[model samples]
Every structure is written in C-alpha cells, then in structure tokens.
Target: MTKTITAVGFNFDEKQSEMIEKKLQRVSYAEEHIIDLIVRVKHEKEYSFDIVANFRWGVQANVKAEDFDFGAALNKVMDVLDQKIKKEKEKVQQH
Candidate 1:
C-alpha cells in the first residue's frame, strides 16, 4: 500500500503554505515510503525551516535551513533531505 504523507506548515500564510505543500507533494512518491512530514517555518529577519520526514520503519529524517525568506529556506532543507535520503538508501543497499 502507498504510505500516507502529511505536510504541516507553521507560521505560513495561505500562499506560502500552499506553495510548500505542493513542493512537498512532489516527493510523496510510493518508493519514498514517507508516512508523514512535518514542515515548520519560522519567519524572522532570517527565515528558518525544519522538515521532519517520518518513515514507516520509524526512521525520521530531519532537515533545517535558514535564509532571507521562509520559502527559500524550505527549499534548501528539502534539497539537503533529498541528498540525505539518497545517501541513507545507498548505505542500506550496501549492507
């Protein structure tokens, strides 16, 4: 069965929240097995974002980034998480 992926937005306006949700949906594929995702955004002089991706196996991957805008920070965090997940999968395959 395909896993359920949930994306949460914190301190985000309607437009930003919708944008983030759509961006996350791009990664919500069957092979990812991401059961849930908690996306927290903090806006200040410097924006900060934290993404917690929960897997069915109880493995939670987290990524954080800071930038001038919350959306940019979120994108950076997503990029990091993408690489992190890829590396983790490679490790698992090698074992």
Candidate 2:
C-alpha cells in the first residue's frame, strides 16, 4: 500500500510537485511500505530538500540536503533516503 506523499514547498506550483514525484520514481525502494512521504522544499541561500519517509511497519527515515541547484538537492536527499530505506528493510527482514 503506497501512501500518498505530501510535497510542500515555498513558491512551488504543479510542475515542481510533478518534478518531485518523478524524481522519487527514479529511485528504487519498496515504496509500498511507505505510510507517508513528507517533502519539504525551501531556498535559503541555496535549494534545500528534505524527505521524511514513514513506514507503516514503524520505520521512519528523514533526510535533508542543500545544493546550489534544485535537482542536486533533490538527488542528494533521495540518495540518503535510499540508503536509509535499504538499512531499514534489512533490519525488518532480520527480525
């Protein structure tokens, strides 16, 4: 069961939201376990992206990154999230 993601940002529109979704799909994760995805975006000197992935199985991962470019920030956060998800998945499996 894939949870709906809430992407909130400062000065954002539909296109930006779609961009975020597409970026998410670019990564490989077992998203069906995700209970919620809260994405916070901001521009404080540079583009900042944060993702909070809450799993229904009680695994939550939070990642934040900043870069000069929006795509870079997004990529960095996703990479962190991916690593976190992998670790959580392995932990769950070991249980």
Candidate 3:
C-alpha cells in the first residue's frame, strides 16, 4: 500500500511529507487492508486536510478536518480514519 498526499495553498517540505507518511504508517489495521491513501490538503481560511483511505475488497474510509495547524488537522482526520479501519478489520474477523 502507498500514500499519495497533495497539498494546496502550501508547499510541503520533505520533512513535513515524511511526517505525514510516518503518521499514516502508525495505523496497523490500515496498513494491512489499505491499498491506497489519497491525502488532499487545502489551505483556505484554515488548513483543511482530506484523507481517502482505499482498502482492499472495495472498502474505503474518508475523513476531513480543518484547523489552523496542519499537524492538528492531520491528526484529527487520521483518528477518524483509524476508527473506520478498525471497524473494517473487526468486520472481517467476524466473517
């Protein structure tokens, strides 16, 4: 699985990009089932981070969050995605 991150209204330095990759990698359940991670960041009034986690077997999770800080927004969105990923993992285990 791979993560694709695109940012608008800001340029992501290598360090910042690596930080995002690291954060996404921290999700264990998402690592196993997720096939593609599409991250779109928009910097309007506030920093908006949108994440699309595309998992295997046609399952997917989408989360959007906004904050003055990019890291905060990213963390928020990732938290929601983690919950969704965990639920999907449990669903598979039950079957």
Candidate 4:
C-alpha cells in the first residue's frame, strides 16, 4: 500500500510526526492499494485534530477531535479511525 501520513494546518516536530506516522501505520492493514492520510492539527482557542484516510477503493474516512493535549487528541482521532476502518473491513468482507 502506498501509505503516507502528513500534517497540515499546523507545524509538527520530527518526534510528533514520527509518533503519528507509527500509530497510523499500525492501524493500516489493508491490502495492495494506494493510501493517503492527511493529519491536520489546528490550534485556535482549542486544539482541533483531524485525520483523513483515503484509499484507492474510493473509501474515505475522517476523524476529528478537540482536546487540550495534542497526544490525547491524536489518540482519540486514531481510535476513531481504527473503528471506522474495522467497520469498513467488515462491510467489504460481507459483500
């Protein structure tokens, strides 16, 4: 799979980028396909985290969360993505 994790709308340090990449990679278990992930962290009054996973199958999933802690927001977003992927996997399997 062509996997890429990118951060937009905010600056991410190397360590934070690596952490997000690793976490996302662990959640990605799809077969041969092009997968592009966009991770956006927006900080205004509160921090907003948005993750978008796009696949060649035309399956697109987005997770969003807001939190004071960046790591916590990332974790929440990842969990939401994990659940969405699992649901999609089941749907594909059933078809």
Candidate 5:
C-alpha cells in the first residue's frame, strides 16, 4: 500500500517517521487490500493524529485521537486504526 505521513507545526524527524512506520506493522496483514494510508499529525497545545485508510475496493476508514504526548497519541490512534482495519477485513471476506 502507498503510505503518506505529514506533520504540521513541528519538525518531524527521521526517528519519528521510522517509529510510525514500525507502528504501522500492526496492520501489515491487510497491506495488500489497502490502496493508501494517510497520516496527518498536528501539534498545537497537544498532539493530534488523523489517519485515513483507503481500501482497494473503494472503502475508507478514518481514526482520530489527541494527547499531550506524541507517542501516547500515536499509540491511541494506531490502536483504533488496527481495530478498524480488522473490521473492514471481515466485511470484505463476508462478501
């Protein structure tokens, strides 16, 4: 799948980018079914994470979360994303 990560209001370093990639491995089983995965992180008073997963069959799922710590927010968002992906996969299989 094609993956895109964008960060606003902060200098997103290589380490952080790598961390995201590593975290995304949680959903690697559904990679072939995913068309694109977009992640946007905004930092104001706190960190906000917005993730969109576009499936090959034209389905889309979005998950969002916010936290004072970057890692915490990322973890929260990714956990939600993992669940969404699993649900979508089940739907596709049933059809």
Candidate 6:
C-alpha cells in the first residue's frame, strides 16, 4: 500500500515519524486491500489528525480525531481507522 504522512504548522522529527510509522503498523494487515493510506496532522491550539483509507475496491474511509496530547490524538484516530477498515473488509468479503 502507498502511505503518506503530512504535518502542518510544525516539523516532525525522526522520532515522531518513527512513532507514526509504528502506529501505522497496526493496520498493515490490510495493506493489500488498501490503495492509499493518507494521514494529515495539524497542530494549533490542539493536535488534530485526518486519516483517509482508499481501498482497492473503490471504497474510501475517512476518520478524524483531535486532542491536546499528540499521542492521544494519534491513538484515537488510529483506533477509529482500524474499525473503519475492518467494517470495509467485511463488506468486501460479503460481496
């Protein structure tokens, strides 16, 4: 799967990037079914994350989460993303 991570309003260091990569690994099982996985992070008064999962079968799932803490926001977003992906996978399997 093609993965892209973009950060706005701040620079992400290697450690932060690595942390994101590790978090993303949780969804690696769906790599073949997913076409593109895009994650956008923005920081202002709080940390916000937007994740989009484009499936190979023309389904798209978008999830968003925000928190005052970076790790919390990331975890929240990923958890939702995981659920969305699982739901989509089930749909694909049923068809």
Q: Which ranges of candidate 1 are over 4 A from the true structure?
A: 1-10, 30-32
What CA RMSD would you report for each candidate?
Answer: 3.7, 2.4, 1.5, 2.3, 0.9, 0.6
Pairs of colliding residues, candidate 1:
none
- Mind giving the per-residue lDDT tens digits that candidate 1 earns over 1-95? 23223334335568876777677666655245666667666665677777777766667788889999767777888788788667666766686
Instruction: Give the worst 10-residue stretch by lDDT in candidate 2.
Output: 1-10
User: What local lDDT does model 5 show for residue 31?
Assistant: 90
- By descending TM-score, how would the candidates be arranged? 6, 5, 3, 2, 4, 1
Q: Please, what is the whole-model Cα lDDT of each candidate in the order they appear?
A: 0.68, 0.76, 0.83, 0.74, 0.93, 0.95
Whole-model lDDT, model 3 = 0.83
- Could you give candidate 6's per-residue lDDT for residues 1-95 as a string of tens digits? 99999999998889879889999999999999999999999999999999999999998999999999889999999999999999999998998
Best by TM-score: 6
Best by lDDT: 6
lDDT assessment of candidate 2:
0.76
Choose 3 or 4, whichever is better by lDDT.
Answer: 3
Which residue ranges in model 6 land beyond 4 Å of their true spot? none
How far residue 50's Cα lies from its native spot in candidate 5, in Å, is 0.3
Worst 10 residues of 4 by lDDT: 1-10
lDDT per residue as tens, model 5, 44-86: 9999999999999999999999999888999999999999998
Report the lDDT tens digits of candidate 4 across residue range 1-95: 54545455667888887777778776757544336777777876666888777766788888899888877888888889888877877787788
TM-score, cand. 6 vs. native: 0.97
Q: What TM-score would each prediction reach against the true structure?
A: 0.72, 0.80, 0.87, 0.79, 0.95, 0.97
Residue by residue across 30-95, what tens digits does model 3's lDDT show?
A: 576889888998987888988888878787788888899878888898888788888988998898
Q: Cα lDDT of model 4 overall?
A: 0.74
